[model samples]
Target: MEEKYFEISTENLKKFIDGIITDNYEVIAPTDKDGDTFYGKINKFEETNLDILLPKMSYKEYLLPKTETLFEYSISGVDTEVKDGLQNIAGANEKRVIFGGRPCDAGAGPIMEKVFNWDYKDEFFNERFKNLTIISIACEKPDNYCFCTEMQLSPESSYGSDILLKKSGDKYFAIVTGEKGLNLVKAYSNLFTETAKDKVPADKDWKKIFEVEKTKSFLDKNFEHNYFQERFLSCIGCGVCTYTCPTCHCFDIQDEGNLKEGRRIRNWDSCQFGIFTLHTSGHNPRVTQGDRYRQRLMHKFKIYSEKFDKYLCVGCGRCSRNCPEDIDIKEVAKNLAEMA
Candidate 1:
């Protein structure tokens, strides 16, 4: 693919982000809040905290919100008026720049796009994506939890990112791609300096890349296997895994208000919940916690891949890291790989 590379000093990185904010663009970056880093809207460049690891939440919320109004209705006398609840958070009206995002988080955008655009196209997600520019920072020091390599992804993978930045010495090498990325480079031309053609920084911390193909092969034959129950017995049926995941996009729609008027709202939902697949007759297809957990694994590793030709997981390892039961996805994948 055609790409343009430019180098910018570490000191000038703040100025580059500040310039985007000054131009009336919403700058969303990793911001420190209560000792935890989260992707939040930043008014100034100083508000961003890039030193932390991956944020507790993914950038999916920016694209598909946790809670959004679908439409609003009002009634006066015998007349009723219905209005569309349009979303303005990072849409055509206000442009967005996601800076200092991890590559795995950046990669989630494309995977989620496939699901959103499947049979029924979602206009809200489509419009906001067009107006957003992703500026992802390559991980310099990945911990044991990082397993992007297993998913055929890495700190350097620029799958869904517009611009990928990697730290090299005292400067950051920016690899520009897509129309929005090139436009940013042209606008802030002074901040970037032309670098050597062959200069590319290496991610030293990422050493072990798991055998994903082997794991997929095992999962292909183990759908009805009894191992799933034992594997997920310790799971507490919490929705933390789906909530922190970047590609989990299940949602529930509910209408709120009295008989006079009401508003339909869409909120994030998870497959781990017992009521997620419950029918109106009080019959739940996934009855036990193990059943829910098995569905989660199958959806991520088998079902989604069979339908979309891509795995639902990006291997960011947040699920494994935050799991109270210490159910490491990487270990599970490795066990499956050994079975094959």
Candidate 2:
């Protein structure tokens, strides 16, 4: 909100997006790879995976990263191993933008900013977030397992995007939502044209977009759907769902190698696993898969909603799409709503 903003047609939207990426910094976006779609760096507009509904993993990798060297310490002749990690953070360039991201994924950015920048400031994480911009695109179609409608996020929700690109008939209608978004528009004046006809997207009503919101209002009523346990009874305790969910933000930090020369690494973790909160004192908090499954549903719907006033899910359907047990979130929400 600290900068000027504008709206443009989706046709010229990609031109503006590609134009920004064409400048300094390497651009990355989601792309379909064989049967599995992944997010990676790209050079051209044709390679973007705009049609793929969900990515293989969340965009957490861009912020926290899988493996990182916190700081390396060495000894010359014993009693010398401390060094400043911030010695050269400024000299290196950390400029880049992600194009064609989804509203759900981009929305997680600000939500993530809260906890990451809280307690004690993580300069490493904050530094990375400051230099990057996220351009989220609107979802055109809902997947079978998608429950975003139940969670109050429509296809065009723009909670945490620098720029939001809405798809029209053949063109895209782009809207700048942040100062960074405004900077992108102002920086590339040639890529955009001032439209006088109020360039806001026309067909973005929630009642029109959501087919199940009116009929399947069970999602609002089913806070205590007991059958989900029976439905998920076939689950083999795979963490794939939690891993692929865009809003699931639990992780574990680990140290590998010998004690004297081990590197501290943080890896993606899931609550579906029994050991997620295992105490070092040998008392298991969540003893069974049922407890873990119940925790996941309640946390997403009941807990997160109470805390953040927003459902932790974006309804991208990556969990059900990649789930080996085919546990559909839509079916669960519908049944719960119906039972209620």
Highest lDDT: which candidate? 1
Backbone clash numbers for all candidates listed: 0, 6
Off by over 4 Å in 2: 2-18, 82-93, 118-120, 208-229
Name the TM-score of candidate 1.
0.95
All predictions: root-mean-square deviation over Cα? 1.8, 4.0
- Cα RMSD for predicted model 1: 1.8
Candidate No. with top TM-score: 1
Candidate 1 displacement at residue 254 in angstroms: 1.0
Candidate 1: tens digits of C-alpha lDDT, residues 1-340: 4888889998888889888899988899999999888999999889988888798888888888899888889999999998877644434535689999999999999999999999999987887777779999998777777888778688788889999998878888998878889888889899998766588665555455458777778878877777788888888889998999998999999989987899999999999888999999999989887788878878888888989988888989898888999988888887878887
Q: Write the per-residue lDDT of candidate 2 for residues 80-138, one digit (tens) a residue.
A: 46444444353343657877778777777766676576587877667777877888888
**TM-score of predicted structure 2:** 0.83
Error of 2 at 57 (Å): 2.6
